[model samples]
Target: MSLTLQDVKRVATLARIAVNDEEAATYQQHLNGIFGLIAEMQAVDTTGIEPMSHAQDLSQRLRDDVVTESNQRDKFQAIAPQVAGGLYLVPQVIE
Candidate 1:
């Protein structure tokens, strides 16, 4: 779709961007080019085309799920100012 100078200015204002007359014209051209490309892409017929996750036919290698670190909950809770029933207690801020 073609964009006029006013359209560019309106878009810039909505986006909270400061664009001069020259910049607006440049942006209008760039946006129009992008829209043209989008239009061209939309014109293509992709009937019965299967969607693909990746271009390459490859399977992801996954590592074995195993616990590496030992439990340090008691050690961490020991240093806390206030901890009850294995839970940290914070002061109530709201009434």
Candidate 2:
């Protein structure tokens, strides 16, 4: 499938984009080229090809999950103005 100048104009109008004739023509050419590439890609047979997640094979380097900091919640909550049932109370700002 290819895009005509009229198609480009109509799409631009629907999208509320301000595009002049020259820009619309350029967009039409670029979109038609993309469609041509898609058509060419679809024409190739890949019946026996397995789908790949990425172009290059790579593995994620990860570190071991470990607790590095001691619990400081009790010390912080002791300085707050309101504390109830192990939770900080705040003023209701909304109804």
Candidate 3:
């Protein structure tokens, strides 16, 4: 998984990046080092290992679902600007 200056330049062009010659050379070496590290990681064997989402096996405690509502329709609707037949009224927008 070695990367060259030409490969770096192509990648930069595909990503819409403007890289100079000097920066391309520097980025080529840096990318090569990163690929080398990834290759090293690939050499390790991970047999019979289970994927984990979190480090601790903690359960999520949730509150119980219950119907608890305040039935104060008349008291709340009293502050509306306009009300007719026990309902709030608003401006009609459509023609």
Candidate 4:
């Protein structure tokens, strides 16, 4: 399927975008070329080809999960204006 100049303009209007005649013609050619490429791709025969997530078959590099910093909760809460039951207290805004 190919998009005509009118189709391009119609799509632009539906999307709330302004497109002049020249721009609509350019977009029509671009969109038609993309559809042609898709048609060509779909014409290829891939009877037994398996789908893959990526082109390259590689494993992701992982790092060891370990604690990197000491506990600083006590140090931070010490400077707060209110604290109760190991939690920070805040004023209730909604009834």
- Where in model 4 is the C-alpha error above 4 Å? 61-95
- Model 1 regions lying over 4 Å from their true place: 62-95
lDDT by residue for model 2 (1-95), tens:
98889999999999999999999999999999999999999999999989999998888999999999999999989999999998999999999
Residues 1-95 of candidate 1: C-alpha lDDT, one tens digit per residue: 79999999998999999999999999989999999999999999988988789998799899999999999999999999999999999999999
> What is the lDDT, from 0 to 100, of the residue 20 in candidate 3?
100
TM-score for predicted model 2 compared with the true structure: 0.71
lDDT (tens digit, per residue) of candidate 3 on 61-82: 9988986997989987898899
* lDDT scores of the candidates, listed in order: 0.95, 0.95, 0.91, 0.93
- TM accuracy, model 3: 0.62
Find the 10 residues in a row with the least total lDDT in model 3.
43-52
Please give each candidate's TM-score: 0.63, 0.71, 0.62, 0.64
Could you give candidate 4's per-residue lDDT for residues 1-95 as a string of tens digits? 98878889989999999999998988898999999999999999989999989999999999999999999999989998999988999999999
lDDT of 1: 0.95
